[model samples]
Target: MNKQVMCEQCHKKVASAWVTKIEGSEVTKFSLCEDCLKAFSLKISINSQNLPLDSYFNCLNDKEFYPERLSNFKMCPKCQLSFADFMQTGLLGCPNCYQFFGQQLRPLLEEMHGSLEYKGKIPVWAPVTYVLNTELKALKNELFSLISQENYEAAALIRDKINTVKEKLTKA
Candidate 1:
């Protein structure tokens, strides 16, 4: 009897017929079996088409993907399907994602950006060893001074800068 190999993604025994090797790239791409290849191929094809992320959500209709990632709520307005529709999922989909599901997406956005409002730019720096502590602390001190002077607009900008610096200093 031949030992069956399973797909890394679906973990089902691939019947050898579905297995195919892809050597076109330098990446080490191989699952012990083939279902993963099919899943991987579909993902690649969908992305290559430049379609929006929401367009291929139907591919997730299989129901085995994300079991319970979200609070397991937030249904799509168009289809009225809840998070339970997919096994595991995140709150990113549709241009109206913020409009349609702001509450649901808060954790996700906070996960990506410390603040939802795009106040301004911040440069990335290496972590650890009191890196931006001085900068952030100084900004905080300056913000307090500005507020004390009753310069409300300037204080707001300084407060935003302080928040941005603190966001950068701390990981999301």
Candidate 2:
């Protein structure tokens, strides 16, 4: 027999959607019913076009979850693409749109990719030091965020990991 999972949000309905967030060594998982998932998706589609998922979920119970309007009037100088156009099509006009709309794109990119920094596979030919440095950089960023959140235990663990990576870099 299969066990059904209840929605974490509504608690009254069986969950149809699951969401997971990973931060450093920490992981968080939650489930949502079909109705609640649809409502949340609709809110993202209709209300906050570029809002971060974290902010939206954090303010789910708030009456004023929507923030001030983004620059609708702003346009990319290279492709003449407006933020509204990008919102509608979900595509940037050109490479220059990255720089032109960087401020507006940051949250959306973070929401979609989890981080502004690219974490794709490194080339096999890449130097060991390069790889170790990249790992150290990411660990340091996580360490800072953990410190800000006052999770000293986790921060200490990350610090040790960072030091280990640094030692590897020195050896390389």
Candidate 3:
């Protein structure tokens, strides 16, 4: 038998949405019922059409929920593209729009891509030193995390791996 999870806010309804936020070394997690989640999303200023959450939270489609006129909406200085226009068109007016609407677009991008940082594919023809350098950087990060958690055994293994990558880089 599975235990039912109650909403953290209302505690009366079953939780339908889970939210997690990680800042630096700290992490926070909570679950919300449909109603509470909808209210929470609204409070966060989630643009309806900008995110796929609108399909799940149908209340966002209601015009009454956002009564402000288009003129009052935030606009990009470079392209003059309003956030409202982006929501309606589902397109950014210019590359500068990313910087202009970074705060609002961040959540949507994170939801879709799972991370803000881009880890693009490296071509097979890329230099061996370049590949080894990337591997060394990732191993160092993992080593730091393991050390922070006091996992010396795992950190030792990562340290060995980093040494091997460094040797390969030196040879290349």
Tens digits of lDDT, candidate 3, 13-65: 87766778566699889988778877764323355444544454576445776
Report the poorest 10 consecutive residues by lDDT, candidate 3.
Answer: 41-50
Candidate 2, 74-147: lDDT as tens digits? 65766667788889999888899899889889999999877899867887689998889888999999999999
lDDT-best of 1 and 2: 2
Residue pairs that clash (backbone atoms under 3 angstroms), model 2 = none
By lDDT: ranked, best first: 2, 3, 1
Ranking by TM-score: 3, 2, 1
Over 1-172, each residue of candidate 1 has an lDDT whose tens digit, in order, gives 1244455566766533233444566445445443334444332346457554334545554466573453365555544344444325543444544455556657666878876777434445644425467667778788889889998899899888877877776673
Clashing pairs in 1: 66-87, 66-88, 67-87, 67-88
Kindly report which residue stretches of model 1 are placed more than 4 angstroms away from their true locations once superposed: 1-71, 79-91, 126-172
Model 3 sits at a Cα RMSD from the real structure of: 18.8
TM-score of decoy 1: 0.26
